[model samples]
Target: MTHADTPAVQGGPELAQERRLVTEIPGPRSRELAARKDAAVTRAVGTMLPVYTVAAGGGVVVDVDGNSLIDLGSGIAVTTVGNANPCVSAAVAEQAAAFTHTCFMITPYDGYVRVAEELARLTPGQHEKRSALFNSGAEAVENAVKIARAHTKRQAVVAFDHAYHGRTNLTMALTAKNMPYKHGFGPFAAEVYRAPMSYPFRDAGVDGPAAARRAIDVIEKQVGATNLAAVVIEPIQGEGGFVEPAPGFLPALLDWCRANDVVFIADEVQTGFARTGDMFACDHEGVVPDLIVTAKGIAGGLPLAAVTGRAEIMDAPHVGGLGGTYGGNPIACAAALAVIETIETDGLVDRARAIGKTMLDRLTALQADDPRVGDVRGRGAMVAVELVQAGTTEPDAALTARIAAAAHAQGLVVLTCGTWGNVLRFLPPLTIPDHLLAEAFDLLAQIIKES
Candidate 1:
C-alpha cells in the first residue's frame, strides 16, 4: 500500500500516525551515537534526550536506532508547523537548487519582500506596518531596541523579569535567567532595565491590574517614561514558566506605554506563529505593540527572524543600520513563505487552539489527582504544568526532574523551564495525531502519579 493508504498504528490522522517506532527507548544505535556526540560536542551545548534522530516528519522523530518517538517539545517551540513539513521542505529544496544567497541588502530578492509582506499582514494591529528580517530572535530583538531608541530618541530599554529574549550580548542583558544562559557571560550591553512581571501563580495577592501598575511605577520612578525607549515583554512568559499574565495586565501596560511615549514591544518569538491560540498573543488582550519580535517557527525549522511594527517606528532606524549579511537567506525565506501558507492551508492556528483544549482537559484532570502539579497554564499548544512540593507552594525542582526523566525513559520527550526550574512545558506539534497526543498525556500522567 502507498504511505497515504496505510492505516496509522496510533490511529488519529492517517498521515500523522503513519509514523511509528521499531525499537526500545534510545535503542542500541542511539546509545552508540550519544557516546560519539559526547566526544565531539561541547559540554555547553546541553541535550535533553539521549537519542539522535535520523529523520523527522509530521509528529514523530525517527531516531538512528529505529525508534519513532512522539515529539512534544517541538524543538522548544520551533517546529510548530511540523518537522520536515512537505510545503516547507519543497520550498527550501527548490530555492537551494536555484540561487541560495545574494544578501538582500547587497542584491535584493522577491522572496525577502514576500516574507516581509506576510509578516505585515499577520502581526497584530491595524496600523500601517513594516518588517525587517534577521537570522535569529536575538538579532530581531536587538534591532527592535535600536529602532525604538532611534524613534523615541531615548537611551533606556525596559524588559520584564523572567524574560528569555535571546543569548546575544544585548539580549543576554535583556534575559533574566542566570544559570546556563547567563552564567559567566556578563559585561552585557548597557542602558537596559528590568521590571517585575505578573506571575499569578506565585504572586497570589497582586491582581493583574495591580501588577501592571507596580511594574509601570518602577519604570516611571527609576528610568522615567521620558527617558525610556521601549518596554518589552513576552505576553505569556515562555522559558520563565508558561506564566500567563493576569487579565487586564497587558492592556494596562499598553495604555501606560501609549501615554508615556514608550514604544511597547511584544517578544513573540516563542508565543507567535499559532503556538498560542491566536496569531500573536497580543491579540488576546487587543494590545497593539509598537513592535513585535518573532522567530523560532517562522521558517518551519530554518533560521529566520523578523521585527514587525508600525511603519513609522520601524522606519526610524537609518537605512544602513537594519540588515545583515545573511538576515534573509533565500532558502530560509522560501521556507518561511511555505510555512505561513501551510499554517493557513492546514488550519494550524485553529488546530493549535484545539490542541490546547485537549491538553488543558487532560492536565487539569491530572492536576486534580497530583498535588505536585501546582498550576496548569498556557495558550494553544504552548501549555505548561508547574510542579510544587506536595501540600505546599514551594517549587519541586527535584520532583520535576524525576517526572521528566520518567517520561523520557518511556520514549516520550518533555521539557522543563521556569525561574525555579519546576515547570514541565508541552509544545507538541499542531499536526500531531489525536491518538499520539492522548498517549503522550497518558504517559505523562502515569509518570507524574508514580513520581
Candidate 2:
C-alpha cells in the first residue's frame, strides 16, 4: 500500500496535496479580508502570512482566494495529527454534542481523567505520575512553576537564553525574545532568572556536557539552588529557532536539579506529541523531567495544555490551587484523547524520524554549498536553518525575512525565528506528504540562493 493508505497519512487521499495559486499571493478575496481584519482586529495581533485560510488537510492549506499553499508551519506546530484530523474531529463533535464544558474543577468528566491517564503513561519516566490540564502552553508553564515552588519552597525560576515559553506575564518573563514578544509588554514577573543555553551554533566548542556546566555555574552563582525552585527549558527550543540542546546538556542539568532539589521542567509545548520523532524530546536523552509542560500538539489544534510529572511533585499544589474555570474543558479533553490515539496507532513517531532525516539531509546539502547558511539543526519534523552573514556567524535577519517573504509569494508558507531573527524554521505536520515537503524545500532553497 502507498504511504497515504497508512494510518500515518494525513486527512486522506481526497485532500489535495499539491500547491496551486490561481492569483497573486494574497488574492482579491484575501486582500478584502485583510482590509476587514485591519479594521476589526487589533493591530498588535500579527500573522505570518496575510492569506485567510478556509480549509486545511494533509499538507495543504486552502485559502479563501482559492489558492492552495503547502503548510510548513502546522499552525505553529499544533496540528500534528493534521488539520481537521478525522479521529479528533469525530471525538470533538461527539463530545461537543453531548456536553462542552462542565469545568473539571467543578464537575469532572471522564475524558479529562482519560487524557490525564494517557499523559501519565506517555510522558517520560515510568514512575507514578499526575497531570493537570490548562488552556494554553503558557498556562501549563505557569502552573508548573507554581507546583515547583510549592514543592521546593523556593521562589526563583531559571529559564535559558533563546527560549520562547509563552506570552503570558509569567511566561513572558520566562521567554527571552524582546522585539515582538516582550517589547514594552512588561514589568514582567520578577524572580525569573535567565541562564545560558547550549547554543552550539553560537557558542564555540561548547559541547553538551560543557554547556550544562556553564548553565549550572550561572545558576549556582547567580540564583543559588537554595533560592531556585525550577530550571525550565524547551528540550528542543521552539520559537527560539528549533535549537536542539547538546547531547549531554539536558541529562547533566537534570542531574544537577536532582542533586540540588531544583525541579527540571521540560517545556515540550512545541516538541511533544510526535513532532520530534520521539513522543517527547526528553526521551532522546533518557532525561525525565520533574515536570513537563505540554501543549500545541496536545489537542490536535484545540486549545489545550498539560503539566505531567511525578505524582509527589504534581500533588504539591493544594486543592483548588491549580485549576481554572475552563481548564480541561470536556471537548478539548476528548480531542486530546483522540490525538494521542492517532499518534500511537498511526506510528507518527517513526514518521517524524523519517521526515527529520529527509529534512536534515536536504538542508545539510544546501548548507554545504552556502556559507550564509550558518547552521542546519533540529530533530524529527522540528528543523531549521540559521542564516548568517557569509563566512561569519553574525545573524542575517534581513536576508531571512526576504527569503520567507519570497517563499510566501510563491505559494509556500514558511516561518522565520531566532534570538537574532535569522532562523528559518520548518514545522510541517507529521501528516505532511513527503513530496509536499520536498516541494516546499525546493522553493525555499531557490529563494535562499536567489537572496
Candidate 3:
C-alpha cells in the first residue's frame, strides 16, 4: 500500500510528553504491582526497570503512580517511532476490529504481503529481494540460518565475539556472552563458530582492515569458507554493547564472503529502522548483506520480525517450508506497515541523525570530564558510553550499575550492556523532544559525577 493511501493515525493517551516525578521512581502503585508480579511472574523473566507502566508516549513512560521517567532505553530499541505510536496503534486497532489473525500460512492477507514488500523496498539493497515474517528477532535469525543452509547446502555458520543474535538454541550458540544468556543453557546447536570482533576501544592501534584480516584468518583456518553456509553478524553489536565495527571492517568481510561463496547475513535487529540514522546499519558503509534480519523497531512495539534477502536465496526453501503459526499476524503486519509509513513521512531517519549529534556532543563532553568513562561510541540514536577504571581500560561494572540505579532513582530510564556489563546504552525514540533528551543527559551527567 502506498503512503498516500494510508489512513489517519490515532492519538495516544493524554499524558504530557515531559518527565515529571510526583513521587519516587516506582512510587506506591508500581511497588504494589511489583509485589503482585513477584507472586505471579517467573524469576527467569527479568526486567530492567521494574516500574509498572500505565502509559507511555513520545519520550516518557508514565508509571501507575504517575511518575514520568525519561525513556532513553526505548524498550531496548523496539520503539524507534515511540511507544504507542499514533500510526501504529491506529493500524493495530483497526486490524483488531476487522480481524485479529487468519494465520498467514492458512489464509494469506494483504497486510503481510505489504509488510514484506516494504521490507524489500526499505532494507539496504537494489537487488530483487523477498521477505518472510516471524514473531521475534530470534525467529528471524533462526529462519535466516535455515534459508542460508538450504541455499548453500553447507552446514557451518560463523558468528563473532561480542555478538548477540538471540536466545534460541541456535542463536544462543551464535551469541558470545556466557553469564546470563548462555550459562546453564548447555548443549546448544553445533556448527556455529565464534571469531574475533573489531572492538576499536579495546583493540587500540588495530585499524579496520587489520581487524577484518584477523577475523578472516580465523574463518579461513577454523571454518573453511566452502563449509560455511553463512557469516552472520550484527553491524553494531546490540546486547553486547553498541560496538560499531571499524571503518573498512565490514566491506572487507563482505568482499571475502562474496569471494568465498558464503551467504553474508547482517542481523539488524537492534540497528535497523532509523536507529542508526540509515535504514540499516550496513548502509553506513554501503555494504549489502545477502540476507538482513530485522525486528525490534519493525512494528512500532508489536512482536514482528522479518528476514529480507536476495529472492533466489530466500526461494531456496520449497513452498510451505518457511512459515509459522503466528508469523506475519495481520495486526502485526498492519502495525509494521504503519511504522514504515511513519518513518518515511515523519523523516525519522534524519531525526535519528540529529539525535545522534545531540547525544554524541553531550556524551563526548561528559567523557572529557569523567575518567571512568572509557569510550563513547555508537551511531545515530543507538549510542553508549563504556565505563572503566580511571586511566585504564578495565571495565567497572559495579560503577556502571551504581550510575544506572542512581539514574533510575532520579526518574531516568537507562540500560547497561556489554560483555563485561559496563556499557550504559541510550536508545531514545526518534520522536523524543530535544529538550527531554538534553534534560535526561544532564541528569545522567550529574548522577555520574556524584557517583
Candidate 4:
C-alpha cells in the first residue's frame, strides 16, 4: 500500500476525525469503559495515566471523555511514526484483508521475509546480517541471548544495572528493577548478572572513560568475560532515566566484547526506529553491535519484535529453535515495512534529531531555571529530565509525581521512570507538530516553575 492510497494522509476528510475529542479525560463514557475493563481484565494489568484514550493520531490522544491530550509519551515510545500512522494503517489493513495469519512457521509469507530484509538494512553495521522476528521485545531479547549462547557456547548473560528488559522469566531475570516488575515474580532465570551502568548525573567526578573502566572492571572480575554469552545494554537506558553512557563508554564496551568474544547486544527496543534521532542509538557512537534487539516502534503499534545480528551468529541457532507462533504476523510485517519506508521517505530520522535539539534546548533552559532539575540528558528525541531536591542531588520522586500530575491536568501527558522514580521522560512522536511540542514544553516549564 502506498501513502497516496491511505485516507489519513491522502488529504481525505477523515484526517480531521483522526484527532477529534468528544469528552473530558476518562470522561463519563471512559469511566464506564474503565469499570468494564476492571471487571473483565486481570487486576495485574496496569496503566500509567488515568485518561482512557479512544483514539490517537499524529501526536495527540483523544480520550473517551472528549479530551484532546498532547501525547508526550508515544505509548511509551511505541508509536514513533505517530499513532494510527496512515502508511502503517493502510499496510496493516491491506495485509489483514488478504491474510491475517498463516503462522509463518507453517507456511511462509512475503511480508515476513520483507520485514527481515528491512531490519538487516536499517539496523547499524555494514556486515552480513540475518534477522528473526518475534512477538514482543522480551521474546526478542530472550532469543538474542539464545543465539549468543549457541554461537559462543557460553552460559551467562550480562546486563547492566537499572535496566528494563521484559517480563518473561528469562527477561525478568535480566531486568534490574525489583518493585512492580519483579517484586513478587521471583525465582527468575539464573546465570544472569548485572553490572553498574554509567550514570553521569550521579557519578559527578567520574568521566565517561573512567565510568566504562569501572563497569568493565566489575564485569571482568565478577562474571569473567569467558563465561558470558552476551552483554545486553539499552544504547540509552530507557526505563532507567533515559541515561546515555559517557562518550567512550559504549565504544569501549564494544571493544571489550570483541576482544573477549562476548556478543554485544544492543537492546534498541525503545531507542530504535529513529526515536533516538539516529536510526539506532548505536549509530551515534559508531558502535556496531553483534546482535540488535528491536520492537516498540517497529510495527507502528503491533506486537512485533526482531533480533538482527551478524549472519554467522544468527544462523547458529538450529532450525525451529527460534520461532514463535505469531512471530512476524503478516499484518504486523506489512506495518513494519511501511514504518521503515515512512521513517526513511518522511525523513523522520533527521526529524528526530531536530526534535531532540528543540527538546534539549528547552529542557536545559528548564534545568537552569529550576534548581530542582538535576540533569537534562539523552540524544535525538529520546530525552529526559532528572528531578532532584532543592539544593542536593537527592531524588525527588514526590516532586516528579506532582509535576507529571500537574502537566496531565493541563492536557499534556508525560511519563516518569527511574530507579528512584524521579525522572521525567519526553517521548513525543518525532512527527509531532512543532507548536504542540513547544506548547507541551512550555506547560512543563510552567508546572516546574509553580512547583
Candidate 5:
C-alpha cells in the first residue's frame, strides 16, 4: 500500500501527514507561544525549531501556525512509531482512565510486568533476562550503571568519545561533549573514563578489532578491568554523529568484556526499538550486551525507558533498589505494550530498514556530488550526514547549521548533532510517507546547492 493509504496518513488524530505551509515556518501563533515560553520556562532548555508543535503524526508535525513540516528528527528519535500513534494513544487513554500513577514499587500493576515480559521476548538474545522501567533514558542508563556496579562490585565505567547518554548528573559525566550537555555541569561523577572509538571516516587506517584494541588498551591501562564495573557505549552513537563502529569493533569489545567480567552496557536509548534496522543495534553484530539501556522510541511518544539485561545481573540489586514513583506508570506501561504490538503487527523493523535504504541511497548520492558532505552513515531510520570542508576532514559546523536552518525554514524538521556539531541527523518516523521522505531530501539537496 502507498503512504497515502496508510492508517497514519489516512487521518488518525486528524493529521494530514503532508507538509503544508499555511503560514511562514514559525508563523505568528508560534511566536506568541515562544514569547510565553521564554517568560514562563527556564532558558536552559533549548528548542530546535521555534515553530511550537500543536499536533504531530506520521511524518508531519503540524505547528500552531497551521503549517505542517516533514519530520526528519523524530523528536531526536523518540516518536519512531509516529507521534500520537493510534495503538499507543488508545492504550494510554484506556490506562489513564483506569488509573494513572500508583507507583509501581508501592502498588505494582500488570502493565509493568507485561512490558517487562515483552522486553525480555523482544530484546536481543534468548537468555534469561529482566527489566526495570524508568521515566527517561537518563534514568534508565543511570540505573543500568547501578545494577552493573552492584553485580560486578566495581565502580569505574568507560564512555566513548562523542557519546551522548543524557543530561543528568551521572549521565552528564558519561556524555563526552563539553559545551551544551556538560559546560556548566561541573564536578561530574568520578570514576568515569574516556576511550577511543572506531570512526571509519577519520580512522581509515584502522579497522574494527584494531580499534577495539585501541580502546581496550586505554581502559586496561587507565581504568583497569578489575576496577571497571561497566563499559557503556551507544551501539550507533546518536548524538555523536550517528557514528557506526567499524565491522568487528563491538564483537571484539564484547569478547574483552566477557573475558574481564566487565558488564558491557549498550546504551540503545536512541537506537533501540525499531529505530535501527534490527530489533536492536546489538543484533547487527550479534553482540549481546550484559545490560541494555533502552528508551526514545520505546512507548510511542510516552516517557518510558528500561534497563534489560541478564537475570543474574539485573537481580544483583537489593530488594529496595531500582524504581521511582513515575517509573513504569500504568499509562506509560500500557503505551509501551501497545508500541510493541504496533512494531510487531505493523512490521516496523522491516519498514525501518526500508527507510534506511531510501535515506542512505539519497544521501550517498548527495555525498558523491558534494565534497562538503564528508560521510553518510547509520543503520535503518537512524542516519546522519557529516559535514566537512572540501579536500579536508575538518568539520564544517557552520555549513551544517546553515543547511539545517534552511531546511527548517522550508518546513523540514532536521536536527544537528556530533561532538563538533557538524552532522545533520535524519530520524524520520517509520510511518513517514515515501513522497514526504523524497520531498524532504529534495528540499535538502536544493538547500545545500543554494548554501
Candidate 6:
C-alpha cells in the first residue's frame, strides 16, 4: 500500500495528489467567497493566501475553483497527521455518536483520563507526570504559567525573543512580536519579561553556552531569580523563522533553570508530535522541561491543547484552579488518543526525520547557488529559508513576499514568517508523498530565480 493510503491520509475526501491549476490562484468562486468574508469577518483576521479550500488530503488542498495546490504549510503546522486523518476522524465519529460532551470539568470521563495517561507516557522523562487539557495553545500556555507561579510562589515569567506563544492577553504578553499581535492591545499582563534568544545566523560569534549566559544575565539583572516563576521558550522558534538554537543552548538554559528553581516551560505548540524529527523538539537536545505546552498537532486538526509536566508541579494548583468549560471534551480526547496511536504505529518520528533531510538538502542547495537565500534551518517537516539581499545580511522582505506569491500563483501553498518577514517556511504534512515535496521545492527554486 502506498503511504497516502495509510492511516495518515486515509478517510478524507480523495482528490488527485498532484498540483493542478484549473483557474487562477484566487478564482471567481474564491473571490466571491472573499467578498462575503470581507463583509462578515472582522478585518483584524488576515489571510496569507486567499484561496478558499474545499477539501484537502495527502499532499494537496483542493480549492473551490478546482485548483489542487501542493500543500506545504499544513495549516500553519497544525495538521501533521494530515487533514481528516482516518484514525482521528474515525475516533471523532465514534465518540460523537456515543456522546459529544458532559463538560469534562463537571463530569469527567475515561477518555480524558486516557488522554492524560498517554501524555504522561509519551512526554520526555519517566518522572511521574500529570496533564491538564485545554482547547487551544494559548490556554495551555497560560495555564502552565499559572501552575509555575503557584508552585514557585513567584510573579515574574521570562519568555524568549522571537517567540510566538498565542493570542490571549497573558500569552500576548508572552509573545514577542508587537506590530500584528500586540499593536493596539496594550496594558498586557504585568511581570512578563523577555530574554534574548540564540539566533545562530544573526549572532555569529556566540555559541550555545555563551548565549545562555547572556540571556541568564539579563534575567538576573531584570527579573531576579527569586521573583521569576518560569522561563518559557520554544526549542525551535516557529513564526520567528524556524530558528533552532545552537547546540548546548537549551541544556545550558535548562541547567540554569534547575539551579535557580525556575520552572522550565517548553512551548512546543508548533514543534511537537514528530514535526521536528523527534517526538518533541526538546528530545533532540535531551533537555526535558518541567512543563511542556502542546497544541497545534496534538489532536489531528482539532481544537485541543495540553500542558504535561512533573506531577508535583502540575498538582500544585488547587483542584478547581485549572479548567475550562470545554477543556478535554470527550470527542477531542478520543481524537488525541487516536493521534497518539497513529504516531506510534506509523513510526512517524522516523518519517519526520526523513522529511527533514529531504527539505534541508534541497533548501541548502538553493542557498549555495543563490545569494538571495541567506540561511536555511529547521528539522523534520518544519523547514525554512531566510531571504536577504544578495551579498549582505539585510532582510529582503519584498523579495520574500514576491517569491511566496509566485509560488502561490503557480499551484503551491507556501508560507512566509519571521520578525523581519523575510523567512519562507515549509510545513508539509508528513503524509505528503516524497515527489510532491520535491516538486514544491523545484517550483520554489524557480520562483526565487525569476524573482
TM-score of each: 0.95, 0.97, 0.97, 0.95, 0.97, 0.97
Least accurate 10 contiguous residues by lDDT in model 6: 1-10
lDDT of 2 by residue, 1-451 (tens): 2223222333443578899999999888788778878899999998779997777898998887678899999999999989988899899999999998788877788998999999999999999999999999999999999999999999999999999999999999999999799999879999999999998888888999999999999999998989999999999998888888888999999999999989999999999998989999999989999899999999998999999999999999888898999888899999999999999999999999999999999999999999999999999999999999999998999999999999999998889989899999998998898999999888888888899
Q: Give the TM-score of candidate 6.
A: 0.97
Please write out the lDDT profile of model 1 over residues 334-412, one tens digit for every residue. Answer: 9999989989998999999999999999999998988878999998999999999888899999999998888877778
Q: Give residue 183's lDDT in candidate 1 (0 to 100).
A: 87
Count of clashing pairs, candidate 3: 0
So what's the TM-score on candidate 4?
0.95
Lowest lDDT sum, 10 consecutive residues, model 4, at 5-14
TM-score (C-alpha) between model 5 and the true structure: 0.97
Deviation in angstroms for 71 in model 5? 0.6
**Residue by residue across 295-388, what tens digits does model 3's lDDT show?**
9999988999999999999999989899999999999999999999999999999999999999999999999999999999999999999999
The TM-score between candidate 3 and the true structure equals: 0.97
Per-residue alpha-carbon lDDT of candidate 4 for residues 1-451, written as tens digits (9 for 90 to 100): 2334222322211333323335554567666666777888898997766776556776787765667788889889999988888888889889888999999899999999998888888888889999999999999999999999999999999899889999999999988888778988889998999988888888888877888888889998999998999999999998878999888889989988999999999999999999988999999989999999999999988999999999999999888888989999999999999999899999999999999999999999988878899999988878999999977999999999999888877778899999999999999887688878887888788889998
* RMSD for each of the candidates: 4.0, 4.7, 5.1, 4.2, 4.3, 4.2
Off by over 4 Å in 6: 1-13
Query: Which residue pairs overlap in candidate 4's backbone?
Result: 22-66, 23-65, 23-66, 24-65
Q: Tell how far residue 135 is off in model 3, in angstroms.
A: 0.5
Give the least accurate 10-residue stretch of model 5, judged by summed lDDT: 1-10
Candidate 4: give its CA RMSD in angstroms.
4.2
Cα lDDT for residue 272, model 5?
A: 94
Q: For residues 27-75, could you state the per-residue lDDT of candidate 5 as single tens digits?
A: 8878877898899999999888998766788889887667889999888
Please list the C-alpha lDDT of all candidates, in the order they appear. Answer: 0.88, 0.91, 0.92, 0.87, 0.91, 0.91
What lDDT does candidate 4 reach at residue 185? 84
